[model samples]
Target: MPITEKEVRKIAQLARISIDDKDICSYEDQLNKILAFVDEMKAVETEGIIPLAHPSEETQKLRSDKVSEKNQRESYQSVAPTTENGLYLVPQVIE
Candidate 1:
């Protein structure tokens, strides 16, 4: 599960990242540590554990679905340069 400088360089090429040649050893060490941590996590036991979407069991609270704002479409559209059939009109940009 250890990462090497060659592997790091290959990963950088695939990810389109520019890693400095001097930082290759640093990146290789960091990646190896991450891989070792993943290997440690793979050793965990979860036979009877149920996957959960959230940490808490309580459901989220919701607000009332009733309308709270008055309709002002006509008032707002009045200032438009051109509008037709309750819809705004725009000039053609492409042939």
Candidate 2:
């Protein structure tokens, strides 16, 4: 099903985004294309196909979880604009 302007607006609201008037039509078109692709996939009959983790059989690298260095808190905080109680202080926005 093609997504309409109202549906786009609803999706924007649900995603907590402010979609501008100029971008609403583009968003609707993109959403419709995505839905159409999904509909096309629904028409395929894959009864016994198994899902694979990766396309190739290459192995991934594993890393050790041990800490290699201590926290450079004092050194890093020395360059900050402001600091208090071992924390970087930033300007407050709200009253």
Candidate 3:
């Protein structure tokens, strides 16, 4: 069903949008066209069509998972104010 001008005005009011009086007819026409297009799309036949994640049939290129950096945890944590069992200690903020 096509959207009426009164519905368009109500929608603008509900959304708290301030539309010009001349623009209300334009919005009503645009919304009606969109609804008509949706109705047209609903009539298409798709009995056995499969949904697709992507339009193209290409696989992603992945690199091998490997460690590329040396461990620097102890070197970095050495400057912290407090640490116990390799964990930095922070003052409790909540009870």
Most accurate candidate by TM-score: 2
Per-residue lDDT tens digits of candidate 1, residues 50-78? 87878987889998999988999999999
Tens-place lDDT per residue, model 3, 1-95, is: 67898999898999999889999889989989888888887788978998776888878888789888899989889999999988999999789
Query: What's the lDDT for all of these models?
Result: 0.89, 0.89, 0.88
Window of ten residues with lowest summed lDDT in model 2: 51-60
Candidate 1's C-alpha lDDT?
0.89
lDDT of 3 at 59: 82
Error of 3 at 5 (Å): 0.5
Give the per-residue lDDT digits (tens) of candidate 2, residues 13-56: 99999999999999999888889878877788888999776898
TM-score sort, best first? 2, 1, 3
How well does model 3 score by local distance difference test? Answer: 0.88
What lDDT does model 2 reach? 0.89
**TM-score per candidate, chains pooled:** 0.45, 0.47, 0.42
Write the number of the candidate with greater TM-score, choosing between 2 and 3.
2
Angstrom error of the Cα, residue 44, model 3: value is 6.2
Q: Residue 33: error of model 1 in Å?
A: 0.9
